[model samples]
Target: AKVYYHDFVVQATKVKRLCTTHNTITVNGQFPGPTLEVNDGDTLVVNVVNKARYNVTIHWHGVRQVRSGWADGPEFVTQCPIRPGGSYTYRFTIQGQVGTLWWHAHSSWLRATVYGALVIRPKEGTSYPFPKPKRETPILLGEWWDANPIDVVREATRTGGAPNVSDAYTINGQPGDLYNCSSKDTVIVPIDSGETHLLRVINAALNQELFFTVANHRFTVVGADASYLKPFTTSVIMLGPGQTTDVLISGDQPPARYYMAAEPYQSAQGAPFDNTTTTAILEYKSAPCPAKGISSKPVMPTLPAFNDTATVTAFIQSFRSPNKVDVPTDIDENLFITVGLGLFNCPKNFGSSRCQGPNGTRFTASMNNVSFVLPSNVSILQAYKQGVPGVFTTDFPANPPVQFDYTGNVSRSLWQPVPGTKVYKLKYGSRVQIVLQGTNIQTAENHPIHIHGYDFYILATGFGNFNPQKDTAKFNLVDPPMRNTVGVSVNGWAVIRFVADNPGAWLMHCHLDVHITWGLAVVFLVENGVGELQSLQPPPADLPPC
Candidate 1:
């Protein structure tokens, strides 16, 4: 494979669309950023130059950093931000991964404007489990905030409450029809009567899990998070924040314009804050007898409700064995943890003393009571360079003291942080299992927990609390969806197992951009094997200095 080296300038550009205009930041001047096509095993050197006003860093989401943690970009977590006018080159090789992944800005709120799809095809002789499509199109779903994203966050931090909702949800950088008044509005897709199209859908929304569907077409979900799944067909699909689903649509139907729509899936507690759904028009080509006007009565297929707990549970179960691809079962290490929201006394400057949260108390989520705070002096990469053994605690609780109570009054609960949480220690090549329990406090928000490096098997998940006896009996030891991230359902807990074969400092944290910014993160250190990973060669001279 050829070595891929590229330079990108992250700058703000004024783009005019749908008769309105706004200044948005882009990489190399492209609104949707740039497409990076590479093959398995190929090395990539991406020099990112920050010309925009905000500090930034680009993270290769879902890629196992494996001794290259410096390139794992999560501001403060992995490395310091590349200051404005500064530059940083991310150097790493694609190893054992051949599918769709993505890259995005990892600094505060910058990712809202900066992101692109990273496509990795298999090496020369490798074949896909399903037949390859004639053409592939990336369909990225994002949230559009009319106000400056930085300002939105700043106001939220100052108000001590939920920030204002976004103006519209976007598809490939365009807000389809919903925000006609907004400058970033996009024209919807026009489909031919009998066309089959591949839609590589990515949910980059900061906090919501979306249910996606076209008016009448059936979608076959084939791949997710850079890995192909055992193909499955569904009318409507649910995608959590930070998750990706590749679907195939067969437009074999009457020619008529229909709306492609996405809405928040119901949470365990109740409907989303805003019940309005985002809509995109899908125009099917005219037939021999052209209709006079667009059909507003196109069939709206039955989709799961935003808070259909049963369906969500079943869908999650179906992703486990033997209905899915086989996963290696022998675990090398087992780590258990409890995740919950706790209250902290906000200093006088931030807000009022009495804040509303779970149980009426001000709340913040944590991994086993200890919210992992990013030290101002340490970068996630610098910590790895200094070694991971001492940077994180290894004593996280094996089991939680209290499971969530969906119907209980969380607002009145008194909460405190868990001290001395344990971190996991593993040798390279050790198989591992991690159980995460959720404590119900305030609201039951979905936690899309993402891990760097290796994909793991989701063993099981349950509500109320985890019953060790019953849950263990139902564990799927065979086929499971090999994913780098899994959603910890509201008021529920999940168990995941994987192999610690990749060496480096990896981060495991909530995919919710807001939660991660507030510090729901941890590091996984995989010790090096004899010698080093073959891909760990020195970077070339003249690399961009960021």
Candidate 2:
């Protein structure tokens, strides 16, 4: 194992797209930023210098910091933001995780441009479980906005409504030739006639789940969220924000150009979203440019309809562990948490003038009816570590206080969710199972819930409310797929289990930027065990203070 050093200069650089130019905050002046390749047991020491105007902090999206919570970044969850002109170094070792993960700004609206790929290859002298590919490429799917993203979220925050949808979807930070003024910057990938390649596809789009496909090529699913899968072939796959999928693609097509395209897989009815496609080109090696400047039409794959819930469910359920998975079958803690949007009534005498939600109410979301509000002065981790009071409470409900038909109509009185900085306490090394139940309060939507610091086994997923008596029988305990994130289907539920082995505060939330802003989140405070190895390491001397 070795230490890797990187200087992440978060500075503003002018980026032009869609016939408009804006000063976008990026790492090291690269739009998609630099890819960090490291071995499984390597340590990463990334010094993030905040040269941008906004307070910033970078989160290693799927890296389990283990007992080193001081390096787990999530604006005000694990640590305070590095103020403008300030700097902080994230130092942590990637213990057992190996595969494609990513790093991004955990602060408000800033991840719109501040992000990069964190690739974890196998440990030194170790080989991949599958055959080595001829080459590997990182395909980062994203969203693009013509306006300042900060302003877009600010307006939504003030009005209590949905934020403005992005202007276009992006593949490797380019909108491809589908949009005007973008053809010149389309990303191109070259491949030999019959070689195989590994595509590390990541969904970094702020608010939408994307469907990705390649013209005249099929993908064999090999891994996801850094965990190896059973390797099944498919034509299309969907990825929610913060999720990564590893697929092997063969260059078995004719010697021609093909378009790799991505669009949204929005399941929420009445939801506003970008309906455009982003693409990149896959050209045969040494393929010449079209003669006489007349370009041939690139072949485009048939993506699923924007609202195809069945397709999304089928793709998600197709994942399976290649071998026996270690799941905590005898759960120590069982919790049922409901997640969805809710509406808060306008204040008395306000007459709905300031509210912009359903029936003139403010929009919000929650887990177990508690809307997670972050502490401003210090992070939950810092407060818990130093015994600081009034920062957060550890009484986050283990189950919904009231029971009802989660996927059906509920009483209007249950529409408002209480907001607080609440966390669930867990004993280190305890096995736990959480039934993430999605509701139809405001509208049923697929919420990609990402849990930091641990990869959990997705035991089972099905539509409508979960019935332990029925669903328990359908659990795939032997070969459940492991992941750091799982998309809770619309009007449905998913069961995930993990050991509370990492002591520290870990934030679990919806990866959709808009849903997170509406308070769809929770924190888990796992108490330290007896020895230093099981407890959090001492805070670094240079740890940023609030």
Candidate 3:
């Protein structure tokens, strides 16, 4: 009901972490950028000015753009990036979504530092479906590199190898007391006894899933991806990049400082990750201060091991809608897409330096054996709207080109994926179901697949390849969780359904930056509907040029 205007200036700033200083790109000079708070149904007009050296685009993650597809920024997906010294205005309204969502830079590697929370409360004069909390806080879990993150990704891109892992994990931009020279600046959340607080936890890490827990406290999860869920209590929560969880915590423990920490939930076997823990303190207002020249450490929580898949599975399975949802039963499009990593045999023309992956190969990923390639001359949306040709093809496969044991030992011959800018076409208002099957070509890892401009219901998920006959019966048509992002389990599959009512070029990809760089992505082009109301709005005048 209200319009909010903001100016986001992306610039370079000197930030020190892990006892080292690095020049970091940031928005408004904040490492975790800026938190945008609005009520449901409010309109946001963000003028993003690219003062940094890199081209950039800001995405309002989990905010269904509806008719405003041009503002759903994903670099070359919806619109071109705003070049350095250039500016672009993104205008879109948040519709019926209310809970925890976030905003981040959609361009290459800039989101490592240019990201923040987008908290949506109930509309004005309206209240939450559940009881009110005493206060609210945004816990942004992020990754930090001692070296420049852009440089890190750039080197990986040049070598065609996996990027270097982050030096440390972060909580609100600090590495916390666990690391050197961080105790003084560890983020502290103050609370009063017997008061309940809402914690909007967002995992903005570039390429890692995280497990979060507060010492001596259990969380009652109330919402995720800006949608309310049936409240469930859990000791820990796992979030893939671009995912969010809203949980309520009560200050019922004895008056003391308790550590709230986040660490990597590394699922890929033999893959390296930052094993460090980042922490914040939940301090009671009545707690006594430390004596002179003496410091007291907060009570640390026992976290799950990095490879704890059982806990992750249990936590994921617990999510359900607060009530029955209108899950589409009659599917107009049913896609069984295989998602996994591959190894491209090193090309002799490129030389050894360029092919630094396993056994001198290049790492790649695909959906249905086609690696996604972004167009350089024009964005997908622009090409589609302006009738531009040769930008992309509408021949993305509905299923794998060659079928085999998806979760079994795959042949080395199938490890290479062909690269193309392909998109799947969908009619307006068509009901769709997609079986995201994880394969074991190179190795299996959890993929946080995210879609722009739409939120879908997660009907069911299970380990191993998804079978229509056996797994279709496992679908939960009623009370299934609705989300904009779903973490396809390692060597597993997840079935999701949604109505293709939003007309636009929407990018669906793995949220892990490295995996997306390896081309685990696709686009869905939803055709315009009957009238103006159901069609995509016109592109803004200041839309960035390619």
Candidate 4:
């Protein structure tokens, strides 16, 4: 209904955390950046000036950019990154989506510091599906590293090893009073007694899935990834790196300060992670104030163990659509894709300091046994539109190249994956079903798969393997949850279905940054329909160069 214009400056700033200072790249110099609030049916025009040292591109994490691929920024996927000292503009409109989404740097590890919230409310004449809350708050969960995040990834790339984990988890940008030198700036959420508040929680960590909760408070989940769901009450919820959750909470407890904290949800066995927690305080204004300069300690919540798979599975399976809708009753494309970690044997003459992993092999990841490699010469969408040859191939396998016991013991010979820039081609408006099966190549682990450009309904999830004969009967067609991301449990399977109505080159990949860097990704190219609007718009004049 309206147009929102903004200017973002990507520049370096001195940021202090955990008693150490580092020069970090940020958007407009804000730690978590500025929150951009817009209503449904509104257009956003953002002019981004890259004043930082490295190249930059901003991706609207969960926004459905309809036919506007030029504005859907994903480094080399849709467009090239804006180089240092250059500028670019992103323009798109919000069609029917309304809830919590976010924006972040899509290049390298810059998103660790350059990220913020993008909230979409209902259109002019529409309202929320559930009752309105007294007020709303955006709670962003992030990770804090003692060293520069870019350096961490650079060292990992140089050595062909996994990146180092962060020093502490974060609520917004602070490590909160639980850590040293953070009590003065701890984030405090003030609320009135007996009033309900809406909390939009986003997990922006680079490589971890987090479990978030508030002390002595249980919230009612209403939406996720911008889609409303059947209101369910839960004590805690889990979020992958690229996921968002919207919940309603009431201030029914005694008026005092209670801790809202987040910790790692580590389902992958033997994977290294940060064991520390981040927190904020929910301060009830109706309670008596604490003595000056001598405040009482906030009450902390009890969270599940780091490897609590049962609790995570139960919470994930509880999501359902608030209303009945037509699921893909008939399928057009059924794909059984195997995704997990693998190993790449180090070259005999390699002389890097960290070149060794397990048994003299470097770490790798894959889908269909193909490691995804991004093109540095041109963007995928650009090459597809200009009919350029040799940039990429549309022969990404429809199924795993070789299939065995997906969740059982895998041989060492089959642990190596080939790297390529490949995409799967599809017709517009085709119904699709993808069975995302987790494997035990290195170790059975939980992977949250995120698909860009479309939201799909989650039909069913089960452990071990997904058998069509037995599992197909368990699909929930009546009220399956629609979401942009789903966490396939460790050694488990999840089935999702969506219509290929958007014509563009879109990416489907694991949300963990480390896994993506190791080649756990694929792309889909949907052909255009017989209409102008069904086709992607021409490339913008200010599109960045490769």
Candidate 5:
């Protein structure tokens, strides 16, 4: 197959709707970015030019770069930031993936405006487990803040506490009607009567899981996180941050425009984040009428409350222990880590001991007591130069002796780089398992943890602590969704297992960009094996410079 190439300029654009004007960042001046369609074996070359004021880099989320780690995007990890007015070309081949993935900015806050859908069609003559829909649409969910997002983070870091919530949640960049006194708040999904539409939904929110539903309609979810699952029908679908779902909506019923909407699924007892942010609207257009008329407000559906624990638990269970296919068990490696929220005092000065926190509070989230520290430079490439050993630590905590210490004095200090750290080493085809425990120290914030290069199975999850005897009995050693990311419940714990079949250095981090910026990130060192996969070939000479 021939290689495909595209050039895009990221810039700001003005959009007018419902008598209101707003500014948005776009790729090549198009909102929701552009779509990239390719086959399984096709090569993709994208030249991303940063025309915006801030630095930027683009990541092919969920696409395993494999040995092409140079193309992996995570500023200061695989590559450096593309400075303002600078350009970088991401080159990689779409190897074994065939489903719905996405692309987004990797630099700080730039993703707020730079993102798009990446659709990989199956190889010739290949088909999915379920029937394909006649029409398909990508519904990218995002967060919107009228104030500058950078400023929001800046203030939070200075205050040493949680940042203020966003002004609204957006579906395809529109905060469908739900906000008060907002005239331009609406999401319009045009659909023909009696036809089915495939809605590809991506929850790109920084800090919240979402519950989505449409008025007077049930959807059959057939795919998730770029992988096809056996189709299942439901009235509402719950998706965590960084997760994606593909559902088919039947337009056979009364087809006047009906509002499709999404809202935060976090409970009131959790962190103090926004509760009533409406992300998008599904507008079902009816068959043509004789004359044009104003579209009456679609009847608003009764949405579930923000803190409905039963609904949340039931929704989560629906996606658990999937029944359709079985994954091979000749696994490769296993690992364990605990996730929790705490506080560490940042020195009043850069390297001084004298420190203070927000209202004298020092709060943060981490995996283990050791918060991940993102290197100032791309550590993977540096490791490759320095012999790949001694760059990362293999001493990650195996298990937390105290799993749920709500009153424990969790460390409130940031991750300061140790002068020397032992690097993690793993051979190809290693089966990996990571046990994540969430401790309720200072605040109980839910963390959506994500890993790069490969997806894993959620073996088990439980609340209020991990007991060796009692917890092991409830393990669902069945067909959990093979996911690249999973949520660590507030004041609870989760155990995920996978195979490190892809050979390359991979990143694992909190999906919340805010926590990621605060140093919640790590790298996996997949050592080269004997035979065909022993070593990786360097990138091409003309590889776009990021």
Candidate 6:
């Protein structure tokens, strides 16, 4: 295995988009930052220098990190944020993972512009499970706000309401020709006749799910979240934030330019979202060029509607492992966690501006009724390792404190969630299954739940409340698809199982940044097992202090 070293300078750079220039926080002054390519079993040592004003930490999303919990960089979960003018090194190995993964800032709202693709090819002397594509491209779908993202979130935090929706959806940091003043900067993807290409599609958007399509080409999905899947062809695909989909596209259409487009998939009934489309041109090498003075437009694909839940459901249900897999049948720790939004009554001392949510209430979210709050004094991992007190409590509930009809009209009393820095303790080698139930507390919507440090098999998913008596029989234990993230369907539930083999303080939360900001998260503190190999590594000397 090879060890790769890199320097990431997180600096503020002035960038123009949507006819306005703003100081955006970026890595190495690159908008989408840098793409790091490595093979499976390779080690990465990234030194992140926080030159920007905001505290920052980079998370290697979907990279298992193995025994390197100290490098799993979720602020206040695994490690403290690298403060301004501070530097921290993340050194970890990519163990047994291949295909598309990503890296992004794990701090407050910084990931809006601070993110990148982490591509893992097969290990040296090994070949891909499928035929090699003639070319590979990373399509990063993101969001852009006219105002400063940090300021936007700060205002939301102050007002105790939902933040302003983004101004535009982006494709590789460009709003594309569909928006004003973007035609000249629209990304163009090149292709040759009859050749196959790999598209590593990543959804790095902060608060939106996206539907992606090509004008005249079909995609054979081969992998997701760095794990191989049974190849299936589709005309459209949906990706929630922090999810990656690997699809192979063949240049079988007429020699012309077609638009590769993405639009929002807003499942929340009345929630406002960026209903704009961002596009890139897929041009064939043999296509004719337009006259110098003439303007030609590429053919655009018909994307799904913003509220197309049926399409999203179908796309997610199609994923399967290519081979019969090992899904744990005997679960040791079974947990039923409710994930959804809630409303907190405005305090009497607070003014109207601070209670701007529906009916003068503040928006909140939770898992099993506990709204996760991060400790400011120290990180959870550091507190646990050093025997520090008052950082967090290991009392996260395994189920909702009070059981009600999850998808039904919830009682007003249950709308308020308690806030705390709580974690669930687990043995290092226990087999676990979690039934992530989506509730209709405020409004039902798909929550892309992501777990750090391990990939779990998505056993099954269905709408309405989860009944283990009936749903357990529907589990696809033989060939369940493995992923680091799964989208809990709107007003529904999903069952995922995995072995708790890696020792770490792993944060599991909604991929939507806004949801996490409102406290839709939990931490799993897996105790170290016997011996050094099964235990977490010691913290680095340069680890950032709170």
Query: Each prediction's TM-score against the native?
Result: 0.87, 0.97, 0.98, 0.97, 0.87, 0.98
- What candidate 2 gets wrong by more than 4 Å, as runs, is 267-275, 286-294, 349-353
lDDT of 3: 0.90
Residue 477 displacement in candidate 6 (angstroms): 0.5
- For model 5, where is the 10-residue window of minimal lDDT? 414-423
Give the per-residue lDDT digits (tens) of candidate 5, residues 1-546.
658999989877775432456676679987678989887888999998878777777888888786777788777667667777888788888876767788888777667768888887776577765666768888888777776676777777666667778767778876655555443546566677777888888887776777788878888887777776666788888777678888899887664656677877764433222335463445555534411332566656556776666776666566643474454455454445666555565555633222234445445555655666655555565555456564456765554333435324444332222222223556776777677766655544567788887777777776776666888676667767667777777677787777666666677887877777555666677766676655555654543343
Which residues of candidate 3, in runs, are more than 4 Å off? Answer: 267-275, 290-294
Which model scores highest in lDDT? Answer: 6
lDDT of 6 at 533: 93
Clashes of 2: 0
**Candidate lDDT values, in order:** 0.69, 0.89, 0.90, 0.87, 0.68, 0.91
Residue 481 shift from truth in candidate 1, angstroms = 0.8
Q: Which tens-of-lDDT digit does each residue in 93-145 have in candidate 3?
A: 99999999999999888899999999999999999988899999999999898
Reference-based TM-score, model 1:
0.87
lDDT of 1 by residue, 12-32 (tens): 898654345668888999877
Evaluate residue 448 in candidate 2 and report its C-alpha lDDT on the 0 to 100 scale. 95
Residues 1-546 of candidate 6 have per-residue lDDT tens digits of 999999999999999999999999999999999999999999999999999989999999999989999999999999989999999989999999999999999999999999999999999999988889999999999999999999999999988888998988899999988789888888988889999999999999999888899998999999999999999999999998999999999999988888898887765422222337888888888888731211566886887777778888889989999999989889899999999999888879989989998899889999998999988868999999999988888899998999999888888887689999999999989999999999987664589999999999999999999998999999998999999999997689999999999998999999999999999999999999999999999999999978
* Residue-by-residue lDDT tens digits, candidate 2, 1-546: 999999999999999999988999999999999999999999999999999999999999999998888888997888889998899999999988878999999999899998889999999999889899999999999988999898999988888777888988899999988788988888888788789999999999998888899999999999999888999999999999999999999989887788899877764422222337888888877456542221767776787887888887789889999999777878899999999888877788765555887778888989999999999989898899999999998899999989989888878777579999999999999999999999887764589999999999999999888998999998999999999999998789999999999999999999998989989999999999999888999988877889
Worst 10 residues of 4 by lDDT: 267-276
> Can you tell me which runs of candidate 4 are displaced by over 4 Å?
267-275, 290-294, 349-354
